[model samples]
Target chain A: MNGHVYIIGLGPGDQNLLTLEVLSLLPTLTDIVGYGPYVERVEVPNTVRKHGTDNRQELDRAHHALTLAQQGHRVGVVSSGDAGVFAMASAVFEAIDQGDISLKTIQVTVLPGISAMFAAAARLGAPLGHDFCAISLSDNLKPWELILHRLKLAAQADFVIALYNAVSKARPWQLDTAFDLLRKELPTDIPVAFCRAISRKDEHIELTTLKNAKSSMGDMQTLVIIGSRYSRVIQPLSDCNPWFYTPRSITKK
Target chain B: MNGHVYIIGLGPGDQNLLTLEVLSLLPTLTDIVGYGPYVERVEVPNTVRKHGTDNRQELDRAHHALTLAQQGHRVGVVSSGDAGVFAMASAVFEAIDQGDISLKTIQVTVLPGISAMFAAAARLGAPLGHDFCAISLSDNLKPWELILHRLKLAAQADFVIALYNAVSKARPWQLDTAFDLLRKELPTDIPVAFCRAISRKDEHIELTTLKNAKSSMGDMQTLVIIGSRYSRVIQPLSDCNPWFYTPRSITKK
Candidate 1:
């Protein structure tokens, strides 16, 4: 009964991106816990118990993990993309701080993985060369005003933006509102790339203009990459699919 | 004698992050060319010829690689991080565009790799959870004025910024100037993370204020991550290392 927890990033919906380090450690785990969809992707051994639920139930899941680890079980709490990036790592810390569970002596390690930003950037040439930012449109925890303010700032700065959790169940209009806010500051012709289910069987990537992106996007599995003023919509000779490139240069000629 | 060139990204220092799809194709190469420092980290077969050089000779190297590939040899032009993101893929494209090389018929494939921003963010917790931007302070390609303008926009928008190629041999003051511009708009207390040689053996990650970062960072290998206004600097209980977390929430409580 080793009492330690390893937080692993499943890496852009693909199992291959899981490091040899993470893969080697998986067998030692007695329990694997994460968001229901994410948990389904992992291949767990017969000895490992699995626990999963919707994203909102993360705190409870984390608390249960801490309790299980306290009882001398080796646990792995997993998340898609790097666990630290918009995943369960911080919530685990917050839960610890809130005194929901007291496992001060427990060993916790955060393993890195390929984020959606990198995966999306790769799928669409190099839209994240010089300066870029990623924002989530879901306003469940924060106010929409703040998201608007950040979007405005990102657009004005001419930063390639990677929008995550762009659309969700309760927040259907959030992505539309974000698109409208960005359209005001950024040129309507700016390239907006939508990469859905990256590195998965249902993978789909499309490059469109910000003006037309709202009508084309839906749900949580999508990631929207808005190119800066310097980003170009290049037509590669190999593929009919439009590719985006953010030049290293900051200024226009 | 099949003439074809494949530009590949080895991914942030670690050989493991290289896609299995890319790794499986490595054995087919006759020659691999890249910057000396970047190529040294890769583990390829002895049958593959290796050509390495400094950064200044990129154009020359691209021409050399194109020549070898045109001579009916399988050539792989290697780059760290994603090949398209500030690497040699564009140089090869530019060389073809210059009409000096008739590689229009030559097959070219740009493979993706993990970028430094993702590796850095994964190491330092989730500063990129919200909207963020990555800007290079290098004045080699653009004027300082444009760099300042982009920085100002990023600051005003409150996007976490990942600054690449921040300091170099000839341009020492560019980073300082960029820092000064950002300091004016962002609070002095905002957390700034300096990650050097990420995923490499000599990696160093430190958390400090934006005001103090200029003096602490080194040359080209460093990546300066400036957290947005929403980013919080928290000391993770596992290690003394300070982690930065950008909340998904728009409003600060």
Candidate 2:
């Protein structure tokens, strides 16, 4: 028997941002698997069995999804935001490459969603309007040295930098260290934004200068966007929120 | 009369990728303004007037949308991908900042959508599984020299690079020049993908090594993804399409 797996991104917290491609597949899913919160976010029919796992058990959950699919069941592996960016799609592929699962009997399709960076950018006004890079500040998967190196180089290149997982319980001090490292290469006046729970009721966007950035401003759910030298702020008029944007311009052609 | 303008991202070329947030706003909009193709993609009631403008007239289109809103029409200015990423959102803000318009006269809200990079990455396994950056190769708005400098620095940072507007008539040689500069630092075998018209009926994806990359493989509509040193390929078993991905890992801690 042959089965299939659909890796779907749920976007941020808002169901309104869910891709029609992913939404269309939900009713047909026999099984749904993901981190507990992400799996709960999907509103599927009663027929689908949901498997929620811990945040760190990606490999195990991927193997489980493949096993279910191999039993001729259609499964959906869910992730908040786009599954391909630091999410479940890679976890499934990594399992196959590591020999933890076999791809001979199962089909896989990955669907994209509205990522947090783009979501936050929309609310904050185009801080990533120019060339930009996104980096995970988590040291669990990579060395802190590498994170520091990339931050310095990104600052040097003047790429608008989006820092994901900027701070977590396991690595509370990393965000501070990163800000310190970035300060060496970037001007103190560069704009930095901390956006949390975007598109949700509790959503908050805070804009401050790099000189005024604080580690406490961000949590696991927060996405920190640091601007390049070219970035600017549009002061709020009366009731409007202040806008941060990088203008479309260049020094020479 | 008070009026509002919503700057929305339609998400790539597919109707399926359009956000429900943007979709839900359609019926409420009295006018829709964007590039011809993007404007055509919106499914609005007959009561809504659609204004399709030339590709180069983003600023004019934005100004029109704002003006229409100021006339008490609920207007939508649409972009193909996330509006904040190289799209109409920034142009609208630029207009506001340049004294071409006054924010006090109209309201603007930007709703995020799935970006092409995230969409392409989902289909290509997880090339952006780790840290990544997106840069537009078009030199019309920015200097060519700056593009080269950023590409070199992105290579040094080992970011999985997503190149947008890789090739256009106005700057046919930019893509080739960019590949040459990246080749100097990246290995010859680094994976590069050309994903064209993704999510549309004629969608095509091709993977090749950086050494084997050709400018002819891409056009204005194609997205070129360059894998970092950590990116890898998963060959198919039997007849399945090959998958490209990057594992979430690092060398040193």
Candidate 3:
């Protein structure tokens, strides 16, 4: 039995954002595994064994999927947002590198999905239309100092910055500190957007300036988009909220 | 007649990579507009009017889309990857900002699609699993110095870098300069991936160390992914090329 493992992203929130490639592959799996919420997002027949665990269990889930696949199961691993963007695709690769020897040869195919940054950016009116960087604000993976260093340098480079995992109950103070740092480093009042639960029924979008942006506006589901110096905002008279975007062409400094 | 405009992405090259939302939106467009190749990619009914143009006329296309929408047409503007990332979303927003007052109030919706970087990274096994930055090498919009400045800062921050619009016949030497710049700044050898025409019939993925990367391996359709210090290569023995990824956690400095 030549077992195979497929890693796929479930997109931000809406099922509509899932790619046809991933959607087509769902029925061919014999087993599926992921974080509880992401696994719940997919619909498969009962014949396919479902394995869902709590958050912060990436390595464990990856190992489980690989082990199952090695045992002649066609396993599918799911992740939120794009699988390669700060998600489970790496965990599976890391498992292949450091796990049991036999698990290394499992055939793995990764399928891309809509990432949170792009999903939120689309709703916010193309705020990341220019050069950009995505930095996760969660300090669980990296040092806070490094995050600050990147924030400063990214601002200096004038790239539209997308902040993932910006705020959560455990780390309420971090995003606030990030805002304070940007205000001091930026010369102009850049446009800022707090996008929460995008594409979901409870979706909330707030537009503010960097000087007035508050960390309280966000939560774990929030993805913050901060525009560069050249970014601008437009208030169309169509009763909708103001839209923000970074222009493609930048004039001289 | 209230005119509505929608800006959507066609994904990398395959129609299967398109999100369900974008696929569903195509048939509803009364008129569709895009670069010639992208416009041809959409399968629309004969009743739908198609507007195809050359490459460098982003401003003109945006104006035309807005004008069509104002005449009570449901117009769709198609871009190659994610509409918001170095694509037509920002151009449409720019047109609204600088165009006629009537165009500003025209209702427009931007839909996100699978971007080239994520598509290429998925094919290459999660090269962007850690903190990452995307920089465009094209100097048509911004100055060359600004691109170099961001490259230096991004590498200094140890970001997994995704270089878009990496090469073209017009600028043959810029990608080579980027490799040289990274080599000078990096302390050790790093894995670099040259992913060209990802998901197309001519798709090519080449994995090489930073020191061994050559400019000739890419074209305008290529997206170069440079792994950070935390990124690693996994040689899963499945008759496949080496897989690359950046682990989620960064151990202490």
Better of 1 and 3 by lDDT: 3
Clashes of 2: 0
lDDT tens readout by residue for model 1, B137-216: 77777777777887898788777888888778788877877888888898888998888888888999878888787833
In terms of DockQ, which candidate is stronger, 1 or 3? 3
The superposed Cα distance between candidate 3 and the true structure at residue A152, in angstroms, equals 1.4
- Model 3 misplacement above 4 A: none
The model with the greatest lDDT is 3
Q: Tell me the lDDT of model 1 at B160.
A: 81
Q: Could you say which candidate leads in TM-score?
A: 3
- Of 1 and 2, the candidate ahead on TM-score is 2
Question: For every candidate, what is the interface RMSD in angstroms?
Answer: 3.0, 1.4, 0.9
Steric clash pairs (candidate 3): none
Give lDDT tens digits, candidate 1, residues A192-248: 888898888999887789878883465578888888877776554543365576765
lDDT of 2 by residue, B112-195 (tens): 888888888888888999999999888778888788889999999999999999989877888888999889999979899999
lDDT of 1 at B206: 77
Residue pairs clashing in model 2 are none
Runs with alpha carbons beyond 4 Å of true place in candidate 1: A100-105, A250-253, B1-5, B57-73, B89-107, B236-240, B250-253
Candidate 1 lDDT (Cα, whole model)? 0.75
